[model samples]
Target: MAVEYHGFRVTVDAKADATDTQWLCRAVLEGVEAQSETAKLPCIELAIPKLKIDVLMALSMVEQTAKQAIDEWWHARQPEMA
Candidate 1:
């Protein structure tokens, strides 16, 4: 699944681990504006720590975690006020 948030493209995926006991989720974030640029920022990948047995729940957790990561990444790049 994919969605656009704050000028970024967030893509999320989930799969059953090798043990098939839980669902593993990950998210990839890329700059939408930099898609055509050669010097684009490297895509950021986030592995959600929360595991779930249900696919839908896993996806939900991944999405929330990814958005939080995006927010933090954006804030870190901003200049601090004096």
Candidate 2:
């Protein structure tokens, strides 16, 4: 994914691998070297659930995208499955 705002251009690469269990996936995100930002972010779990919900939602979206892509590829080769 690539995004440009103001004068800065950011590009990211993400990879997800399914675990032995189908419901969970391992995800990793890497930013282009030139655009990478390394910083310590705050986490306050006691006050709100926003952080956890946002993370899970993003992961769910990624999983959905992967599932759609794989289904398309599989169905194209086997029309009967459609």
Candidate 3:
């Protein structure tokens, strides 16, 4: 449902509707592709698999954040224009 990042690049994404943590993680990766330069930037960390995954994978996605998810991703990839 959303992407969170540091290191001047996006890192994590959170989702609730996904069937599992891994699925949500993939969705985040896909979202980054659709919404950011993630597709172009091969070095983005979105592909790293989580080792200590949380059992509470289902998250209450913030409607506000979800709505802005695309914009947030775009910003991360193009902060200068944002």
Model 1 scores worst on lDDT over the 10 consecutive residues at 35-44
lDDT of 2 by residue, 1-82 (tens): 4443222232323332243222232323322334233311121111113334444454455444444443454467468979
Error of 2 at 37 (Å): 36
Off by over 4 Å in 1: 34-53, 79-82
Local accuracy of candidate 1 as per-residue lDDT tens digits, 1-82? 9998766777888876677666677777777755322323344433433342467777877787777776776666654721
Every model's TM-score: 0.69, 0.37, 0.24
**What are the clash counts of all predictions, listed in order?**
0, 0, 0
* Number of the candidate with higher lDDT, 1 or 3: 1
| Clash number for candidate 1 | 0
lDDT of 1: 0.65
lDDT of candidate 2? 0.36
Candidate of highest TM-score: 1
Residue 6 in model 3: shift from native, Å? 21
